[model samples]
Target: MAALACSPADLLPLLGGNATSAAAEYICGRFDAVSSKFVDTGYAVDNTYLLFSTYLVFSMQIGFAMLCAGSVRAKNTMNIMLTNVLDAATGSFFYYLFGFALAFGTPSNGFIGQHFFGLSKFPSQSFDYGFFLFQWAFAIAAAGITSGSIAERTQFGAYLIYSSFLTGLVYPIASHWFWSADGWASPARADNLLFGSGVIDFAGSGVVHMVGGIAGLWGALIEGPRIGRFDHSGKPVTLRGHSATLVVLGTFLLWFGWYGFNPGSFLNILKAYGVSGSYYGQWSAIGRTAVTTTLAGSTAALTTLFGKRVLVGHWNVTDVCNGLLGGFAAITAGCAVVDPWAAILCGFVAAWVLIGFNKLAEKLKYDDPLEAAQLHGGCGAWGLLFTGLFAKQAYVNEVYPGVENRPYGLFMGGGGGLLAAQVVQILVVAAWTSVTMGTLFFILHKMKLLRISHEEEVAGMDLTSHGGLAYEFEAEEKKEISF
Candidate 1:
C-alpha cells in the first residue's frame, strides 16, 4: 500500500464538530501506525527486487567465463577462465573499497564522487546494500570484456594490474560522469543539463560497454596480435575456439541475464505512474523495457544469420552469436525509452555495425579473439547513437522525471540536442579510455609485463603459466589393469 499523505489536523474536517480530542488522537495514532507499515512494506519490496536483480547480474560472470573459455584456443582455456573468475573476485574488493565512493558518493563535485569511502555510514536513507551489490556486478562485467581481447597471450600479472585499475578508477570515473545524479551529463541532474539534454545512456552503453571495448582495443593493439594470427604476407589466420557449444551456451546465458541488466537499471519497481492504484506504472515500463531488449537481440541474431550466410557463403553459429550480442549492447542504452519497433531497427543496424567493424579489423590486421572490441566497442557506440535517434518523448519523461521538455531522440522530433550529447559521450568515453588504458598497456609493454614471451605464446599460457593444459587425455598403462 502507498503511504497516506494525511495528518490528524487534515482529518478533523471528516469528524463531526462534537468529536472529542481523545477520539481525534486515537484516530491519528491509528493512521500513523498504518502509514508506517505501508512505508516499511515499500522498502521491503524494493530491496527484495534489487537483490534478485543483483543475483541475475552476477550470474553474467559465469556466462562470461564460459564464453571466454569457448572463444579461445584450448591451450589458453584455463588462462582465460581464471581471468574471468578474478574479474568478479578482485572487482568486488576494489569496488567496495573505493569504486562505489568515486561513482556515487554525493555532496561532491560533478566530476567525481567523494563520499561513502569504505561504505562509512552505509545503508543510509539514500543508499543501501542492495544498490552497492548491483553496481559491483556491473563493474566486474567491464573487466570481463577487456579480458577477452587480450586473451591467449597476455601475462597473468598484467591482467591483475589492469583489472584493478579499471574497476577501481577508470570505470568508476566514467560511470560517475553519466550515471551519478550529480554528473554533468546525467539526465537525473537537477540543473544545467548537457546541451539542455543529458546523454541518455540508460544502461551504460558508453560507460560500461564502450569503456571496456576501448580499453580492450588498446590492450590488444599494444600487445600485438597473437603468434600465428597473421602470415608473413599479412594474410589473416583463423584461430577458432575449441568448442562452439560453449559459445552458444554462454550467449543464451548472457541473454537471460540482460533482463536484469536493462530492466534492473530502474533500481526500484514499486513506483506508480500517477496514482497508487493505477494499473500502469513503473512495472509496466519495466515490462516494456524487457520486450524491447528481446526484440533487439532477436532481430540482430536473424539479421546476422542471413548477413553472414551471404558474406561467407555459410551459416556460422559463432558469427550469429556475436551479432546477437552486438544487438543487445546497442539496444541497452535505449531499451527503456524506445518503442519495440525502434528496438528492431537498432538491432538490425547493430548487426551490420558489428560486421563492418569486423571487416575493418581484419583489413587492419587487428585480432580480437572474441571480437570484444568490435562487438562491444563498435556496437556500443551505435547503441548510444540509436538512443539519440529513437528515444520517445513520453517514455523519456517517465524514466527521468522532474525534467520538463527535455530533448529526446532527434529523429523522434525532439531535436538534435540529445543526439549531440550522445555524440559527445562517444567521443569523451573513447578519449578517456584510450588515454588511461592505452597508457597502462604501453607502460606494461615497455616493462615486459603485458605480453608473454614468444615461447609462452607458442606453447600457450595454460601450460606455461597455469600449471597444465585445460584438458589432458592419455592412454592408461597396462599396469593400471592391476587396479
Candidate 2:
C-alpha cells in the first residue's frame, strides 16, 4: 500500500520573507478552514499506544514463570516454566477464538456477550484490533496465575483442560461483568447500577486478579497438598523456594510490567477524559496513575520487610516478593481513581492483607504453592474497596463524563455507596469463579486426571512428566557399575 501524499500547494510555506503577505494569509485561511472539518482523528497514535502497552503486559508471563519456577523445588523448574510458556501459546488462540467475543460482544445481554465469532460483526479498525490484542494479553495473564498456584503437583494434561476453560469461558464472563460497555456493572448504564452508578474496577483488580485467586483457591483444595507439605499431625511444613534471586528478579519484572497494566487500562490517552485530543487531561491521568502505582508497591515492600521481621525475626525475601505483588494487585483497581496518599494507604494495608491471608491459608491447610489466593485474590479485593474508600468525586467526574450519578469514595464525602458495590463485586466474582473452576477441576479429578501418581510426585514431576531434568548439571555423577 502506498502512503497518502499532500499536494505541493499544501506544502507551500506560509511564513517566509520571500512570501507575499497575501499568500501567507491564504495558506493560514486554508488550514483553519480544513482543520476543524478533519479532526486529528488520533487513531494511529492511540492504537499504537495500545499495542505498545499490550506488548509490555505480555512480558508478565516471564515474570510469572520465573516467580513460580524459583518458588518451587528445583525439580519442578522445567515443568513450571513450560506451563507458563504454554499459557501464552495456548491462551492466545483460546481467547482469540472465543474469549474476546464472550467478553466484549456487541448487542450484549448484560450477562454474556451474545455476538462474535467471525470478523463479520467486529469492526476491522485499528482501535478494535488493538483493543483485542491488548485484552488478549491481560486474559492470558489472568490464566497464568492459576498455573503458578497449581505448580509441581498437577498433571500437565489436566492443566491444559483447566486453562482452556478459564481463558475461553471463565475469565471472559468475569471481565464482561465489569469491563464491557453494556455490562450491568458498567457505570454508563443507569438503571442497573450496583450502588451510585455501577461497580468500579478501573484496571481489573477484581476482574483479572481475583478471578485467578478464586480459581487458585479451588485448585489448591481439589489438588490437595504436595508430598511433605503436611506432617502426620497435619502441621504445615515449610517448603521454601529454590531461588530467592529469581523470585526477586521476577518481582522486578512484574513491577515494570504494571506501568502498562495500570495506566494502559485507560485505553486511549488522547480521549480518556472526554473531548477527543485533550492531551493534558490524558497526560495528567497517566502521570497520576504512575505515581500511585509506584507508591503502592514501594510502600508495601517496605511494610512487608518490617512486618515479616516482627513475625519471624527475619525478613523473608519470598514474602517481600509476595508483598510487591500484593501491592501491585491492590493498587490496580484504583490507580487511576485515587490520590497518591490513598495508594500508599492501600499498599500499606495490602502488605498485611497478604501476610494475614498467607498465614490463614496455611492454617486452613490450603496447599497453594505460590500463595496466589492471598496475594492476587485478597489484595485484589482490597484494591476495589480502597478505591471506594478514597477515590475523589472530582477525579471520578473527570474520568467518567456525565458522572453525576456515578459512585465515589467514602472519605471524599461520597458516602458508603461505592464501597458497598465493591464488596458485592468481589463477592459475586469470587463465587462465580469458585463454582466454575471447582466444577472444572472436579470433573478432571473424577476422570482420574488431575494430578500425577504418588510415585511420580515423589520422584519429581520433571522426571516423570517431561522425561527429563530441569537441573541435569546438578545431578550426582553416576558410579561405575559392579560386574
Candidate 3:
C-alpha cells in the first residue's frame, strides 16, 4: 500500500503552522506544491540523474577497454576486449534478473530483503525506475573491476558464468546488507558486534569494488599468474599498459562518474528535511556532499603525484589515476557527514595508503594485474574506516538525528566505540565476501572452467573467443617516434 501524503508544500496548511511550511520549502528544494502532489515527477528527475550517472559510469567501460587492451601483451588484446564486453552484457542481464531484487527488495526485519528471483513484483508496481538505473551502473562497474584482474588467461565461458553469479548473487547480496533500507550494513541501524554499525560503505567500499577485486584475487590465485607474469623463481617481471594515455583517460572518467555515484546516494534528494526552520536540512547536506567529494578527489590526485616521486623516483600516471580513485573511495563514507577539511585528510591519507598497499600487494604476490586489489579492496576498507574517524557531530545530528545517530568517532570525542564498530564491519564484510568468492572460484577451478588454454591466451581472445581481432597491422608501421 502507498503512503498517502499532503503536498509537501501543503504540509504547513495541513498542520496549520508557518514554521513547518517554511521548513518544508527548504527541505523540498526545487520541488513545489504541485510537485509534491506528483511523487513520480521527483522520481522522474532522479531517474534522469540515474540515467546520466549510468552513462558516466558506463563510459569507464571504454576507458577500461582501452586501458586493459593497451596494458596486456598484443597477443591477448582481443581476449581483454572480449572479457570487458561480455562482462557488461552478461552482468547487466543477471543484475536485472535477480540482482536488483536481492539487493534492493523491500526490507524485511531490517536485515535481508525477501524478494525472489528478478524484479517479479516490484517493476510492475510504482517503483523507482531512476534508482534502478543508477544501481545498474554499479553492477557494471563491479563486473569491470575484475576484467583487468583476470584478463590474460580467463576462459570466456568461465567469465560468463562468473559475471552472472557476481552481478546477480554475489555483489547484489553484499550491497543489500550495506546500502539497502533493511540491509545489515544500513547506516540507520544501531551497532551490533556481529555486523558492526551496519556497514557504512556510502559508495561501495565492500559493495562494488572489493567484492569484484576480491573475486578477481581468488580467480587469479586459482588460475595462477598469467603464464609469464611471474618468472620460474617467483619474481615478478614488469608489464606495461599498451597506452599510457588510455590509463589516464580511464582514471578521469572514473573520477567524473564518482560525483554522480556519491552525491546521488540520497536518492530522493529533493524530499529530505530536518526539524522545523532548520537550515542544516536535506538539500543543504546534499550540496555539501558534492563539495566534499570533489575536494577529496583533487587532494588525492595531488598527493599521489607527490608520493610517486618519493617512492618510485618518478611520477607515474597509473599511480595518480589509482590514487584519485582510492581517495574517492576513501572519502565515500564520510562525504555526506565529514567537513571539507576532513575530506582533504581523507584524500591525502588515502593516496599514501594506496601507494603503500600497491607495494604490499606486489610483494605479497597477489598478481592483481590492475592492482584492483589495492585500489578497491585495500583502499575501500580504508574509506570505511575513514568515515568512522572523521564523521562529525553537526552533520551526524542533522542527517541521522536522535535515535538514528550512532557514537561519534574518536576525533570527534565520541571515544573508541565508533572505531571498534568500523573494525567489526571490515572483518565481517571481508570474511563473507572472501569466503563466498573463494568457494565459487574453487568450484569453477575444479570443473576446469576457469582458464583458457595456453594457445588461446597467446593468440589473443578477440580471435579465440569472439572470432576477430581488435586491431590488424597488415599495413606498414608509421614510425614517428616522439621524444
Candidate 4:
C-alpha cells in the first residue's frame, strides 16, 4: 500500500519546510482548491439544468394557446391565440420589472421581497439569472392558465391588464409566502413546528395553478358566460368547439409539457448541501418525481375514460382531456414526496374531483370552457391534501434535509397534524386567490372593460377583434366552389 500510494506532498519540502510540515500545508492547499472547484462546478451544472428546464416550461405557453384555441369557437380561435401570445409577453415584462424581486428578494418581515428589481440584485457571478428565468416561466404560466376559462368574450385590453397584475402582484405575493425562505408558510420558516414543514407543496399546485383557476372563476362570473351559453330558461347549451382533433392534439402537448412542469419543480438536486459526493449528478429526486407525474396523469386519463362512460352513458373526449390535466394538477404538490402507488391513487381520485367540480361549476351557472375551475382549482386543493395523506417520510427527508422535525403522511403513522396543516394551506391559498383575482375582475367589470359588446361577441372575435379568421382555407375553398 505504501508503494502504491507515494507521498506527492513530500516534494513540497524542497520549497522550504520539513517533509511533515510541507506535506500538511500542501494537502490543505489542495483541499481548499478542490472544494472551491466543487462549488463552482456544482453551480454551473445546476444553473444549466435550471436554464434548460425553464425553456421546457416556456414551451407550455404554446400548449396553452393550442388548448384554448381548440376549445373555443372557430371564430374566436385567432383571438385566443393572440391573447395567449400577449399573455406571455405582457406577463414577462411585469415580472421582470418587479415580480421576481417581490417574490425572492430580501425578506421584508416575511411578507414581501424588497430587492432584485430591475435585476440589480442579481450578482454578476451567481446562479440567480437561471432562477429568475425559471420563475418567470412559472409566473407567465399562471397568468396564461386563466385565459382558457374566460375565453370567447373577454376583451383583449382587459386580458392584458389581468396578465400584468396576476404575474406582477398577486401571484408573486403568494409565491413569497410559500416559496421564500423567511416566509410564514414555509415549513422551514414556520414559527410553529406542529404544522408539518409549513405546507409541503413540492411544486406550485396552490401557488401557480390554484391562482389561475380562481382567477378564471372570477372572470367567468364577471363576464357572465358566453352569449347563448345559457338559454332564457337558464338551461345550459353545449356549444361544442370547432375541432375535436385539435383538442386531442392540444391535450397531448400539455401532457408533454407537464413533464417539465412537475419534474422541473425540483429545480436541481445538485443544490448546496445535497447528497455528499453526488458530483456526477446521478442522485436526485427528479427521476422519481417524473415517474409520479407520469403515473398520475396516465392513471387519471384511464380512470376518467371509463368513469365518464358509466356516468354519462357515453365517452366524452373533452372530459377525458380534463381528467388528464386534473391528474397532473393533483400530483404536482406531492409528486416529489409521495410513493408511486400513492400517486396513482391521487390521479384516480383527481379524475372524480374534476368531474365533481365541473358539475358544481355548471350548477352554479359558471361556464368554464376548459374546465379550469375543476381541473386546476379543485385538483390543486386535492393535490395538497393528498400530499398530506400519502407523502412518505423518507422522500420528504430526501427533499428537505437537516430537519429532524420534517413532515410525514398521516398513513405513515405521523398523526393528523400534517393533514391538518395541509387543510389550512388549501384554505389559505383559496382565500388569497379569491380575494385578489376577484377584486381585479370586479374592478375591471365596473369599468366596463372586461367583456365585448353583444354584437361583437356574436360577430366572432377573430373578425371583430383581430380583423381576420384563423383558417383562411375555408374561405378559399368556398371561393373556388363558387367560381
Candidate 5:
C-alpha cells in the first residue's frame, strides 16, 4: 500500500492565524479518517485484482488435463488425466502447507526462505492471503509441466512421490532464488545484485518453465523413453496423440490463462508510473506486457506453421500449438521490459528452438509425448537470453525501481551485466533442478517404482492400474442384448 502523501501537520500552514486550536484539531482528525479510508480502498482493489488473476492461472490446470489426455494414447488417457487432476489437488495441499512459506518468507537469507512455515503470523504487512493463493497457482504449474514428459509409462506411486516433492520443495526453492525480495538472483534485491544487475526473470521463464523442463528431461532420460518409442532397428517411430481436438482446445485455454500468468505478475494494477494523477502507470505497463505475450505466441504459431509445413510436408495443429506455447515461454522473462517487435523475434526464434530440440530428442531417442521439455525448457532458456539481449532500459527501470544507472540489455546499449546475470540464472536453475529432481528420478528408477512392467506398458496403465480405459465403447457395446 502507498503511504499518504500529506499529513495534517503538512496542511497546517493553510489555516489562518485567526483559526482556533480546537477547529484545527477537528480538521486534522477528518483528514486522518479520509487518509485511512484511501489506504483501505487501495488494499481492497489490489486484492480483488490479485484473486481474479489467481482464478485465471488456476484454470490452466484444466487446460493441462485436456492436453495431457489428448497427447497420450487412448489406452492411457484416464491415467494421464488423473495425474493432471492430482497435480492440482495434491499440489494444493503441500503448497499451502509449506510451499508458500519457503518461496516468500521474508527476513531470511539469500538462498532459501525460513519463515512463514504453515503461514504463521498470517497476512503481515508485506503479504496477504490473496498473494499466497496466486503463488500457489504458479507452484503447481511446474509440476504439471513435468507430468507431460513422463506421461503414459510412469507408475502411479512414483507420480505421487515426485509431484509432492516438486511442488513442495524443488519448485518453491527455484522461485525463492529469483522471485523473492531476499532471493540471490532477484532484481528486486536491495544489495549485492548478481553481476550488478541481478536476473530479470519478470515472470519466471527460468524459475518455473526451465525448472519443470529440466526435471522432466532427467525423468524421461532415466525412464529410457516410453516402450517402443524407437523400433528394434533404432529408427524413431512417431507415436501420434489420440486427439487433436483436445490439444487445440487445451492450447486455447492455456493461451487465455497466460494473460493472467504474465500481466498478473505485477500484483497491483493501481500503482502510478510517476505522479498520483498521471495517466501512465502500472496498468499501462500491464497492458503492454499482455501485448508482448500475445505477439510472441502469435509469431511462434505462424513460424511453426510454415516451418513444419516445409519439413513435415503438411500442417500439424499439435506442432503449431506446441510452438505457440514455446513462444509464450520465451517471452515470459522479458514481457514487461521488451518491445512488442522484440517479442516477435523472441517467438520466431523460440519456434526453431523447440523444433531443433525435438529433432535432437529423436536423434538421442528421448521421448516426451507432449514435447514438454522442448517447448518449455528449450524455449524458456531462450526467453532469458532474449531478455538479456533486448530488454529496454526505460522499461526495466520502471518495472524494477530503486536502482540508479542500472544495467539493461546488452543489445540495448546497457552493457553485458544484465546478460551475465541472466546466464547465471539459467546455469543455477539447470544445476539445482538436475541435482534434486534428477537424483529423485534416478532413485525411483532403481527401486523399480518409476516405470511399469513390460506387460503393463503394452496393455496401458489405464487398464492395469486405473481400473479401465478412458473410452469404453466396446465394453458398452457388449452390454447390448441380442435379438
Candidate 6:
C-alpha cells in the first residue's frame, strides 16, 4: 500500500504553477510517489462519414434494383433483381480483390494505377479499410446503373462479364485518373495545363456516372431493342415498366441518400488532409456540398414536373424521378464548389437537358430502357460547366489556400478560360469512355454471346436466364385451376 499527502491547494499549483511556487511534499512515505499522465490513444472508427457514404451508395443499389425490376416486364422482375444483387455482391468482391488497387493505387505515374491487386504495398496505418469499403459501394453502383438499360434482353453470362469488367477495370481506371492522389485530374497537379482548376470533379460526374452511362450506351447498341419494341417499318414502341410504385419508391430512397453521397465524399468532415488544413479543406466544403446537392435535387424534381406538363401535356412520375437524379448527377462534379443558389439554377436547367436527351435517344433508335445517358452523361456534363460558371473565389481560396484561384464565369466577370477547361474535360471523358466501352461491346458481339435467342427474350429473363419467376402467385393460380 502507498500513501501520498497532497491537498487540493497543492494540486492546483502543480496544474498551472508559476516558477516561484516551491511547495514541497514533506511526506515521509514508505512507498515511492510518482506522477503519471495518461493519453487516451484510440483508433477512431470514422464510420459516421463512411457509413453515410456507404448507406447512400448502397441505397443507390437498392434504387437500381427497383428501377431495373420496374422497367422490365413483370415476368422478368426476379431476374432483374437478381442482376442487381449480383452486381453488388460480385462487384464488391472484385473491387476489393483488384479493382480498388487500380482505382486508388499509390501513384507511380499520373495516368492509370500501376498496382496489381487490393491493398498491395499500402501501409495499414496509411488508409482506413472502411474507406476502401465505401469506395466499393460506389463501384457497385456504377456497375448496376447499366443493368436497367439492357434489362430482360442481355444474356446472364454476358451481363456478368460486362459487370466484372466495368467494376474491375473500366470504372477503376477512370476513377484513378480523377479521384486518386496521383490521378491526372488531381487538383494539385499544375501539369494538366488545360485547366487552371485541373478537371475539378468534386464527386464523380466524369468518373462514376459518365462511365456507367457510356457502358450502358455500348450495351444497348450491341443488344438492339427488345423484341416487339419495333415494327417491320421501324416504328418505335414504348414498353412500360412493371411497377410505377416501385420506381417512385426507389427514387425517394435515392433522393434521401444523396445527402450522404455528395457530402460524404469529403471522407472526413472534421479533418481532411489535403492542403495545410484550410477552412474549405473538408468540413466547410462538405457543408456547402450538402446544401448544393439538396437544392439541386429539389429544383430538378420540380422542373421535371413542370417540363413534362409543358412537353407531354401530362405529369409523368418517371420523368420527375429522372429529373431529380439528373440534377444530382449534374451537380456531382462540383458539389463542393458551387453555391446553393447556383446549384438550384444548374439543376433547373439540367431537368430540361435530361428530357431533351431522353427524346433524342429515341429519335436515334437507341433503346435505352432507363435513360442513363441523359441522367449521367448529359447532366454530368452540365455539372462540369456549372463549376466553371459558378465556382466562387472566396470558396476556392478557403477550400484550396495557397493555390492560384481563377475567377471566371459570366457572373464572376471573367472570360472563357474556365468554360474551355470544362469542355475539354467533358470531351476527353466522352472519347475515352466511348472508345473503350465500345470496343469491349464489340468483342462481346463478335463472340455472339451478347444477347439471348429471340424465343428466350419473349419468355422473359426470369424463366429463360434464371429459370425462376417473380410471381409464384400466378403459377399457383394456374395449378388450382388444373386441380
Candidate 1 vs 6: which has more lDDT: 1
Clashes of each: 0, 0, 11, 2, 0, 0
* Model 1 vs truth, CA RMSD: 2.0
Instruction: Give the alpha carbon lDDT tens digit for every residue of 1-483 in model 6.
Output: 123345544554555554232333332121123311111111233456677677777887788887777767887898789888999888977887779888776754777776647676654544667678788888888888778777878878877888888888888888877677777766655565345655667778877788788788888988888887777777788888878888888888877777777888877655544675465446667778888998898899999999899988999888888899999999988787777889989999999889888788877787877888768878888888887788776665555445564544646654566667777778877887788778888888889878888898888878876768887888899999999
Expressed as tens digits, the lDDT of each residue in 1-483 for candidate 1 is 456665667677789898876787789889878898989999999889888888888888888898889999899999999999899889988998889999999876789999898999898877999999999999999999999999998999999999999999999989999999999899999798998889999988899999999999999999989999999999999999989999999999999899999999999999988777999999999999999999999999999999999998999999999999999999989999999999999999999999999999989999999899999999999999999999999999999989778999999999999999999999999999999999999999999999999999999999899899888753244447556
Candidate 1 stretches greater than 4 Å from native: 1-6, 9-13, 474-483
* lDDT agreement with native, every candidate: 0.92, 0.84, 0.73, 0.83, 0.92, 0.76
Q: What lDDT score is found at residue 460 in candidate 2?
A: 85
- Please give, for residues 74-146, the per-residue lDDT of candidate 4 as tens digits: 9999999988898899988999998988988864657798888878856643337888888899999898889
Evaluate model 3: give its lDDT: 0.73
Clashing pairs in 4: 187-197, 187-198
Superposed model 4: Cα runs more than 4 Å off: 1-35, 124-127, 190-196, 271-284
Best by lDDT: 1
Candidate 5 residue-wise lDDT, 212-286, digit = tens: 999999999999888889999889998888999999999999999999899999998988988889889999999
Kindly report which residue stretches of model 2 are placed more than 4 angstroms away from their true locations once superposed.
1-41, 118-120, 124-127, 272-279, 476-483
Worst 10 residues of 4 by lDDT: 1-10
Q: Tell me, what's the RMSD of every candidate?
A: 2.0, 4.9, 6.3, 4.1, 1.6, 6.2
Q: Between prediction 1 and prediction 2, which has the larger lDDT?
A: 1
Q: Which of 2 and 3 is the better model by lDDT?
A: 2
lDDT of 2 by residue, 287-349 (tens): 899899999999999999999999999978888889988999999998988999889999999
**170 in model 3: Cα distance from truth in Å?**
1.1
Ranking by TM-score: 5, 1, 4, 2, 6, 3
TM-score of candidate 4 versus the correct structure, residues matched by position: 0.92
Worst 10 residues of 6 by lDDT: 34-43
Tens digits of per-residue lDDT for model 3, 306-420: 8788877998887777788788877877788889999999889888888887777667666766777677777778877887887886776556544443566669875666666
How much lDDT does candidate 5 score?
Answer: 0.92
